[model samples]
Target: MTILKAMVLYKQEPIENNPLIYSDIDKPEPGHGEVLLRIRCCGVCRTDLHIAEGDLRPIKLPIIPGHQVVATVEEVGEGVQEVRKGDRVGVPWLYWSCGRCKYCRRGLENLCDNALFTGYSVDGGYAEYMVAKADFVHPIPGFFDDRHAAPLLCGGAIGYRALRLTGLLERGEGSLGLFGFGSSAHMIIQVAINKGLDVYVFTRGEQRQEHALQLGAKWAGKPTDESPIKLDAAIVFAPAGWVFIEALKKLDKGGRVVLAGIYMSPVEKLEYSLLWLEREVKSVANVTREDVREFLKEAAQAGVRTEITIYDLKDANKALQDLKHGKLKGSAVLKII
Candidate 1:
């Protein structure tokens, strides 16, 4: 029985306590319609943090947690035809959705009730190898290398979904506000700017603010600081609910606020006036296969680049701790190969 080294979560606990246990598990084989990947790297996400710390209840215990995966196909199972061995692919958060569900029929597979999410509902790519649904994996464009491509699978795809939900794409031109300047925002700001939107970034750290400016954001300031102009739309990537409100405060009358986090702190009571106009608040549930495909193409065209901090696969716990404490300047990637 061949074994593979993986970071497994036996239980949820504070990331400070380092809950992921390093272990040698039996190597997984590709099932029917699945493809086995030799994982090159996995991007550490805030969702991983939430799952690790118990903010998002565990669906599968002793699971390997990482969704933003960049890998090469090492083998394919029965009925898998779209990809062959050595093909580079990316596995995102939305692993597989029941095509017969109402939401799936409506082309809203991101909201499918019977969906199995990578890393949360199933073992993900924080290891040497993983098996993923062949139909769900996206071909990693040659525009990005393994490390840089990992963040795009989730951080970029979900951010693109949140941006689309904000209705900025419909307008073609407007002031766009980003409430957090972490992994997603940094990449999204580049796309927004390329689309001719005036990008305003609100984050806590001076270093993050400068990073936003460097990424072509028109304005960068703390969440509490007033933007130079009212935003036509905003996306809150921070897990704090207060930042959601802050983005709302900077929005124009008909603007929408899209919450991008999988888990966030409880929002305070809303003042009626803050939402009195045609304003709307929506939460991004997850990403669809279309979202991943479109985002990858658009991001490549826009020359979107992810600034990453690399960590050895064994140092995943430290990566999550840094993410929780705002210690990372950009995305964090676990190098598995």
Candidate 2:
């Protein structure tokens, strides 16, 4: 039996409680239609923090807690041919879904009731080895190295999908507001700038505001401050629902606000006047495979670059702390291999 090092979350508790502990465990093997991967890197996401801090309920206990996996396909299981040995690949949050479900049949697998999520429902990639459904693992483009591509699997991909829901795909260009200049917002601002959209960023941290300006944002300021111009669309990536309310007040008539988190704190009261004049609000759900592919393609073509702070796999808890306190700039990624 092969032994591997992994950071296992034994309980759903606060990060201060040290929920995740590093341990030596049996290496996993690929099952039928699955493939084994030697993990090189995994991006730390807010969702991981949510689970670790008990904001999101855990579906499985004693599970590894990471999903933005950048790895090498080390082995293939029975009937798996999508990837060959030594191929570089990525594993994202969407683990598996029953194709027979009506949501799946309608190409809305993200909303399927039978969907299983990596790091939440099953074991994930905060380890030396990981097993992934062959079809769910994506082929990483050669342009990005392990650290950069790791985040695109989740943060970047979700930001891409969420941005699409804001009507940018149909309208082409507009004034955009990104509330919370965190990991997802960093990638989104770059893509929006690449598309020639005027982007205004709102973050309470002066450092994040400056970082957004360096990324070519038309303007950057605190959420309490106002945009010089009304936005055609807004996307809220923060866990606080108050960002939605604040962003709602900045939209142009007929503008839209897309809330992009899997979980959020309760929103304060929404005034009818803020949503008058045909404005709309919608929340983004889990991403479809199509969204991932499309995002990867467009991101590559646009030469999108991700700013990240690297941490060793052993320091995942510390990394989570930095994210919670906004100590780390850009995105956080764990270098395991």
Candidate 3:
């Protein structure tokens, strides 16, 4: 058996004391319709932080934690055509879905009941080698480097899905509001600006607001204050429910609000008038394969930029800690040999 070095999370705890242990494990093999990838870079997302801190339970112990992966194909199994040896590919959070399910038949694979996640359900890209289903991997654009493409796998793709859910793609001119200025929201602002929409950003901290303006947001302010102009549509990326209420109040009539984050604090009771004014509130769930393909095509053309801080694979725990405490400005990435 061939051995490979990998960072394994054995128990849920704070990442400070190195909750993730480095060890030598047997390298995985490519089964039928699978490919073994040599991981280059993997983006550290907020969901990884949640898994490290034990907030999102359900993952089996002694697992590798990483999802947004960019890698090169090292080997391929039988019946693999989408990728071959030396091909650069991207592995996203959604790993596999049962094809015969009702949701999968309708092209809504993200909603498939038998879905498996990359890092959560199986060993993922935190190691030098990992195996993924060939059909699910996406081809990285030629213009992007490994580090640049890693963030796009999750943040850029999911942000694009949230933006599309808002109905802002068809509207040529309107005020678009982003309720947070993190990795995902930053990408969304760029896509919105590229489409000729005026972008407004609401986030805490003066530094975040300034960063938002630097990224082409026409106006940047705290959620406590009112916007200069009412927004035609808004996407809330903050994990605070109060921010959701604030965004609804800033929307124009018939405006839609897309809740992009997976977890949020409990919302306090609010008056029904907030939703009574034809203001729609919709949640963005897991993304479909179509969402991934469309976003990659647009990202290749729109030239979306990612602000990232790179760390060694051994320091994944540190990266998660910094992300949990909001120490980094943009996205964090872990580089594997």
Candidate 4:
């Protein structure tokens, strides 16, 4: 019964209350088809905040909450192929999806009913060690260091999925609106800029707006502010449902709004006019393995760089607290290694 230090949540509470307790727990071993990883870094996410505050119902209690994990494979279990010890890998939100499910068979594993989520359903990387399904983890790109790669596993991958859902790529070129300037949206804007899309950003914070401008946004203002031009597509990264409605108001006819949050507040009742004229709304679900792979490649090619604020492993609560209050300028990463 080897012990390892972890920030564990015994119960859900407000992030301000410091719900995560740092303690020594039994270090997990690599089960069959799984691998043991020595965590290097983990990115703090809004989803982690939601789980802390009980916005999203917990699937498992006493969980170690961190999904954006960058680690080195320390050992491989029986029947594990392709992944070897000493490989640097990343574990994302979608931990495992039953391949035999109908949704998985149809290549919609992100929507698999029998899916297990890292950090949510099982223990995740807010620790010195953890075990993950070998087939589910992805090899981190050589160019990105551990801290930088952490955010890409979740924010970059999911944000990329939201961008694709907007149908902007198929349309070739168009104006794109991002309704937040946080971790995910910032990364998405870089990719959108690379595609030659005119990016407009809507966020409340002055610094965030400036950050958006610095990242090549054509326009940056509050969510309530009117866009200079009608947008062909918009992605709302804020958890507040009102931001979703605001994006719709600025959309051109037949444009789409893709909501990127894993858990969002109840949306305000939408007027029929917002949905009229083929204006569409869609939500980004969990990321599939394909989404992760594709996003990593695209991010690497686009030279997507993350603005990160570093934290220590024992200070997971503080990291998430800053995240909840919007104190973080960019992604918050725990430097565990």
Residues 1-337 of candidate 1 have per-residue lDDT tens digits of 7888999999999998989988999989999999999999999998899899998989999899999999999999999999999999999999999999999999999999999999999999999999999999999889999999999999899999999998888788998899987778888988888888899889998988998888888889999997899988999999898888888888899889999988789988778788978999999989999999989988988999898999999999999999989788678999998
For 221-287, candidate 2 gives per-residue lDDT tens digits of: 9887978999999999887878889999999999999999887799879899999999999888888
lDDT by residue (tens digit), candidate 3, 199-312: 999999898899899889998999988899998999999989999999998989989999999988888977788777798989887887777877877777778888899999
Q: Supply candidate 1's per-residue lDDT for 105.
A: 99
Query: What is the lDDT, from 0 to 100, of the residue 56 in candidate 4?
Result: 86
Per-candidate RMSD, Å: 1.8, 1.8, 1.4, 1.8
C-alpha lDDT (0 to 100) for residue 206 of candidate 4: 97
lDDT tens readout by residue for model 4, 1-337: 9888999999999988999999999989999999999999999888898888898899999899999999999999999999999999999999999999999999999999999999999999899999999999998888788898889999899999999899997676999999988788888898888887899999998988999999899999999997899999999988898988899999999999999987678986989998899999899899999999988887887788998999999999999988877688779999999
TM-score, every prediction: 0.93, 0.93, 0.96, 0.93
List candidate 4 stretches off by more than 4 Å. Answer: 265-269
TM-score of structure candidate 2: 0.93
- Candidate lDDT scores, in order, read 0.92, 0.88, 0.87, 0.92
Better of 2 and 3 by lDDT: 2
